[model samples]
Target: MTKAWAEEILDWNYEPPYDFYNDNNKEESMKELLEAPYFAVLNDSGNLAGFYCIGYAAQVPLGYLFGAYQEDCVDIGLGMKPELTGKGNGGSFIRFVLEQVKGSKSIRLTVADFNERAITLYERAGFKKTYMFAGEEMSFFVMEKRSL
Candidate 1:
């Protein structure tokens, strides 16, 4: 997420705070995603489209529903190039990740409540809201998908 790109998500209203990519810290962000089991999305021409990282986290944010569920779970983050937002690439990107995590029984992610478009997309991809929380400045849905 670049500074310009982070600004885009900020426009979505009610989104949770994220480590908006500062030009200075951009390299650090890329370094983390460039490294392992992460799936890097690419275009038909072989250019990178976006990237996602999957793992387990007790909670996406501290004190936001704090801690409850654990064990066999997947956590993830994804960002498509800003220009690609309305282009319909998310569904496929998520499907690809699911294919890679095929043997896992569940996957989880956090989405801010103000992002209606994103929430709808996840629902279409089979994720169901399992938990929700609202803090002084943000609200979010903690969703999960059972193995397909």
Candidate 2:
């Protein structure tokens, strides 16, 4: 992702409950986004639709202790523009992302258990919960999709 796009993503703010996904540190977030395993997604109108990251950037450190990511899978992390959420666009967006990572035999992602909307979306996208672990304040589930 470009610095400009990363800056835009860092500025996005979500409502309560989802606000935890907001970026609090621009410097650190920018560094992560511009580094490897990160990419920006744009819509047909060329607007920043979302962003995704692979590997370590996609995992929660605490999950490692619980053996949540021991499987051979492509771990992915993604977020949509706050304004675009809950508008019936998630399925297509996720499908597009899965297509991008279709080369992988298996894909994995971690999600907050409370975010049922996201969990449902992932399930619809063929991701099944494989493990659950507690975070500093909440709980997270490690979901995976196999055979592309």
Taken over the whole model, the C-alpha lDDT of each candidate is: 0.62, 0.92
Cα RMSDs, all models: 5.7, 1.0
Task: Summarize candidate 2's per-residue lDDT along 32-131 as a digit string, tens digits.
Answer: 8888689899999999999888889999989988989888889899999999999999999999888888874699999999999999999999999999
Off by over 4 Å in 1: 1-31, 34-37, 56-59, 63-65, 68-71
Native-vs-model 1 lDDT?
A: 0.62
**How many residue pairs clash in model 2?**
0
Cα lDDT over the full model 2: 0.92
Let me know the TM-score candidate 2 reaches against the reference structure. Answer: 0.96
The candidate 2 region of ten consecutive residues with least summed lDDT is 96-105
**lDDT score for residue 145 of model 1:** 87
List where candidate 2 sits over 4 angstroms from the true fold. Answer: none
Candidate 1: residue 74 Cα off by (Å): 1.6
